[model samples]
Target chain A: MDAIIFLIFAAAAVIFGINVVLRTHPVSSALALIGVMASLAVIYLLLGAPFLAAVQVLVYAGAIMVLFLFVIMLLNAGSEKKSRGAWMARLAGVPLLVALLTILSFVIFRMYPRSVGVKFGSFAAGTVERVGSALFTTYLLPFEITSLLVLIAILGAVVLGYKELD
Target chain B: MPANFVPPSGVEYIRVLPEIILAAVATLIMVLEPLTPAPRKRALGYLALAGFAGALAGAAAAGWRTGPAFSGMLEVDGFATFFRLLVILAGLLVTLVSFPYLRREEAESGEYYALLLYSVAGQTIMVSAADLIVLFIGLEISSIASYVLAGYMRREKLANEAAAKYFLLGSFATAFLLYGIALIYGATGTTRLNGIAQVLSDPRMAPAGILTGTAVALMLVGFAFKISAAPFQVWAPDVYQGAPSPVAAFLAAGPKAAAFAVLLRVFMTAFAPLTGRWLAIMWSLSLLTMIVGNFAALLQTNIKRLLAYSSIAHAGYVLVAVTAHSEEGVQAAMFYLTVYVFMNIGAFAVVAYFSRKGERYVEIEDLAGLGVRQPVLAALFAVILLSLIGVPPTAGFLGKFYIFQAAVKADLLWLTVLGLLNSAVAAYYYLRLIVIMYMKEPGDSLLELPGMAVSTRAALWTSAAAVVVLGLFPALIR
Candidate 1:
């Protein structure tokens, strides 16, 4: 059952990810990206990382997608204009990409054989409790530093967005 | 919870005292900015300067006591203290330069100083980070603040363009870095530098493989981008040219040094065993960076762009030390960076002084007959420029000498020779500025240049004195 679910979500993710690049309009690309994120969330669930799946949906699909949509609307971007370089890129890009993909897959298979197949629930360490404990204990430094990062980001936004008062 | 989980000790707080002080002061500045009146904003600069002084003291105190903190996520060692002091000093100089410029532009606010402090704090974290995840967070914090600071003058179109270009390219580079970290974690099953080293050494745990090689390459690309090394330095000229001069000065000196610190630590400590694997790569990069940077700088008319290329070449020189892979090599690189901060920032301070309002006089020709109009400023600028060319009696000469000596000691004779040749080529451009300042006739409109502000003069003279002092006493940094 987990294998079937994983296959479906993985396929959806790949398709939507491709669409994200292929779409001409900014809004369509953003929507396609959201779809990709959602499908990846489902794949995370199949991998027994339910906490990760929920956070992926909430943070990535929900909050980040909204921000993307807002920016798209604010910019009022139309369909991307087709440039002359596209044909040149297409001629050289596809073959190179295919070669890279083939080499990567070959390496991956050689490194990790089918004996180590990953099945849902075969490794159940990704529970919320486990993650919380790890984050607050071993990863506490990074967890706190993340707040500082966010604070910097907020400060940056305000400095850039607002005008200087006379 | 584990049966015997031990919480971090109270000493961990003291271990990060400099960063803690920086962050607290930055937050205080942010909080006080809105409450204070506009005309009284210079007080904030003084306050920020006080904070930087305190942090510098804190860094000194922490430097005396070195160990891991926050469960080994960060380390307060000699390397970290050296860079933390360098960055704090740079921050202090930048704050001094910004006060007069901000008042002139009517952009004096607590937020500007706050962002500068925050960026310095971020850089401190970066040098001290012992874990890859912590490093990434630090990198993000610094990069974000820098992006905003680059565009601090929102009214200028060039500033906006600079901020956009820097943001896009910086984000791409960071993604590359994070992916590299992920791949390394995948290969070694660890994110801690020591843990990764242990795993690499343990044959039973993991084999030295292709994944690790790829990870190193990717991370090198990221570091190269940050330091503005050749082939990955496309964004720097434009960003530097477009940014406000003081901010550009800070970016060139502080962040570049911090990036070098992290690069040295990661490669030396975490990937020590992979030295043979990465040495050839560093050699080629060092050679290419020197060649491209010096040759490209030769054709630049704009002083800022020329300095940008020079900065890239400086990175190349540092890479030569990294290739040496010795303790003396690392020390040489640190010493070079210390001297570099003084000379480079001093040069930019002069540039900022001559830039006038809205940074109009940045072209090499714009400096014509400056020696006659303001002889002291022009003479000081000459000394700074001479130092940059690695002339005698200036810190740049000693810096280059030490780096080359380390390289020769490592038997990298060819790289040392090539680097010397690049420095020789670099002399032409630095000389051109001096000639323009002294020999050429003043332009018709250049007769009435503004008098130097006390703060600007103070910053310039301090850097100038430091250059000569450090040059004479190179052992001070050593």
Candidate 2:
């Protein structure tokens, strides 16, 4: 059952990721990217990384995607024009890409044979409760520091974006 | 493992007192900014100054007890305290320098002071962080605040360009650093410095050489960019050239110092076993940084860009000390940076004052015959320049002397020789400005530099006094 769900989300994620690249208009690409993110979050859940899945949906698919759209709108970016370029990329890109994938697969299979695999709850430690427990104890300093980082980001946006100050 | 989380004790809060004070004061200034009238905005600068002073006192108070805090994320040791105090002082001096510069630019606001305080707060965290995650967050805080501060004068085209380039390139380098940290954690099964050290020292559990080496190389790339070392130093000249003079000063002294502190702690502690592997790399990097920084600086016509390159060369000298990777090397690097903070800040403070309205007079030649117009200010500028040249009776000479001494003890004879020669070449550019200020004929553009304001004079005198006193006493930092 887990494998079936993983396959479905994994396929969806790949198709959406490819759509993101094919779409020229930035907003379209951004929306496709969100689809890719959402699918990936489901895959993370299937892999038993429940906390990571939630964060993927909340931070990446939600907050970060919104940020991407805001930037696209702010810049009023148009669809990318076909470049009078990439001759070398066109010539070597596909063959090099194939060779790269072959090498990567060879390395992965050599490291972990087909018999070596994960069970449904292999990463059971990644439950949201455990993550929350760790966030306040072992990771408390970094968690608190993250608030300061966000504050700085807000202050920077105001300093750069505001029209006038008395 | 315990099922329940352990709440932090009270001492942990005291360990981070300096950062807490700085952040609170900064947030306070932010609240007051909207309430205060326009003419009273300088009062916010005074508030920021008080914040730095209070933070400095807090560092001293916190220094007496040294141990880990907050689950070993921060280590309140001698090294952390020293750098915390140094960065806060750098903030204090930069705030002093910014007072007149902002007023002259007609861009005075509480936000500037707030950002400076927050940036210093970030540096304090950076110097204390024992875990890579905390260090990375602290670095983000400092880098983000500095990026905004670099372009504070939103009206200036140069400031905007400075901020953009710094932001894009800085984020790229940070990604590289984060990858390196992840790789290190994968190899060692931990992000804590001493945990990594234990794993590295245990032969049975040792990480593969290739993995740790690659991680170190990536990290060095990030640190090199932060310190403006060679090959990754292309941004420094341009950013410094365009940034407001005071912000450039703060960037050169504060963030750069904290980055060096992180580099020293990580390399000297966690990666100590791999010294043989990285030592040769540090030697070459040091050589390259010195060669590039000094030779390129000779051609710069803009005074700010020249100092920017000069600072890069100084980073190379400190790198030589780090290449030694000995107790003496850390000591030498510490003393060298302490001296550098003052000398570099003093020089930039002079530039801030001399640049005048809208920063119109940044050319090296524009300093012609300043001795006739303002002898006192020119003399102070000369003192700062001479120290940068590593002349005797100035802190720069002692700093370089100690660094070379450490290099020799470590058998880095060749680097020592090449470094001495590089400093010789560096002297020519620093001297050129001093000579121009005292000898060359004053140009029409050399309108008698406006009477130095009290804040500007305070900035100049304090830094110069630090350079001179540290030069003579030597024991103060040692």
Separate DockQ for every predicted complex: 0.64, 0.49
Off by over 4 Å in 2: A1-24, A81-120, A163-166, B1-4
Instruction: Compose the digit string of candidate 2's lDDT tens values, residues B43-131.
Output: 99999999999999999888877788998999999999999999999999999999999888888999999999999999999999999
Which candidate leads in lDDT? 2
Q: Could you give candidate 1's per-residue lDDT for residues A1-166 as a string of tens digits?
A: 8888888889999999999999999899999999999999988888788999999999999999999999999989999997768675779888998987886676576667523577687768788998998898889889998888899888888888865635
Score residue B68 of candidate 1 by CA lDDT.
94
* Candidate 2 clash pair list: none
What is the CAPRI rating of model 2's predicted complex?
acceptable
Steric clashes per prediction: 0, 0
* Cα interface RMSD of each candidate: 1.9, 3.0
Tell me the fnat of candidate 2: 0.65
The Cα local distance difference test for each model comes to 0.89, 0.91
List residue ranges in candidate 1 displaced over 4 A: A85-103, B1-3
